[model samples]
Target: MTDQKSKDPLHGITLEMILTQLVERYGWGEMGRIIRIRCFNNDASIKSSLQFLRRTPWARNKVEALYLWYKRETAG
Candidate 1:
């Protein structure tokens, strides 16, 4: 067997960690403005955000984009 690993684009990362970082970098209010998604605009929470991201591919994409952007912009 080969000892190879498939990397996650969002590897070694948790959804809550991504969300927390985004919220810190952009703030929940601004995230809503930027993504214009309901999860950010209406009462945002870790559980709710995870639920949306798990089922909504487009929203998940946006969130992942935001994560990369945040990682770059903030030097995190």
Candidate 2:
């Protein structure tokens, strides 16, 4: 038997963790500009963003993509 690691960068990461890191790195203002979603643009909160992202697939995809980009950019 062989142990295989998951290739996905987000495999063990939760949406909350991703959102928290992004907020810490970019803040809500930049995040709004980056993704252009109401949740992040208007009265943004971690709880609200999490709810919105959980319900919206496209939005969630964008967030996940952004997280991956952030990770790659900061890898060094």
Candidate 3:
């Protein structure tokens, strides 16, 4: 038998982790500009952003996509 590794880039990563990384790299202002969601645009915090993303699929998708892009950009 052979063992195989997951190819997913976001495997084992949580929503909170993605949000934290984006905020750390871009800050709330840039995230708001990039994503245009109320949670990120108004009084943003990791907790609040997590709540919003958990409930809103579209918004969450945007955030996740941005995170993937961010990771690729900074992977060097």
Q: How well does candidate 2 score on lDDT at residue 45?
A: 100
Q: List residue ranges in candidate 3 displaced over 4 A.
A: none
For candidate 3, lDDT tens digit of each residue in 13-61? 9999999989998999999998899888889899998998999999999
For model 1, the superposed segments whose C-alpha errors exceed 4 Å read: 1-9
TM-score for candidate 3: 0.91
Count: clashes, candidate 2: 0
Clashes of each: 0, 0, 0
How far in Å is the alpha carbon of 53 misplaced in model 1?
0.9
Candidate 3, number of clashes: 0
Better of 1 and 3 by TM-score: 3
Candidate 1 lowest-lDDT run of ten: 3-12
All candidates: TM-score: 0.79, 0.96, 0.91
Q: Pick the candidate with the highest lDDT.
A: 2
After superposing all C-alphas onto the true structure, candidate 3 shows an RMSD in angstroms of 1.1
- Mind giving the per-residue lDDT tens digits that candidate 2 earns over 1-76? 9999999889989999999999999999999999999999999999999999999999999999999999999996
Q: Cα RMSDs of all predictions?
A: 2.3, 0.7, 1.1
Cα shift from native, residue 56, model 1 (Å): 0.5
Cα deviation of 35 in candidate 1 (Å)? 0.4
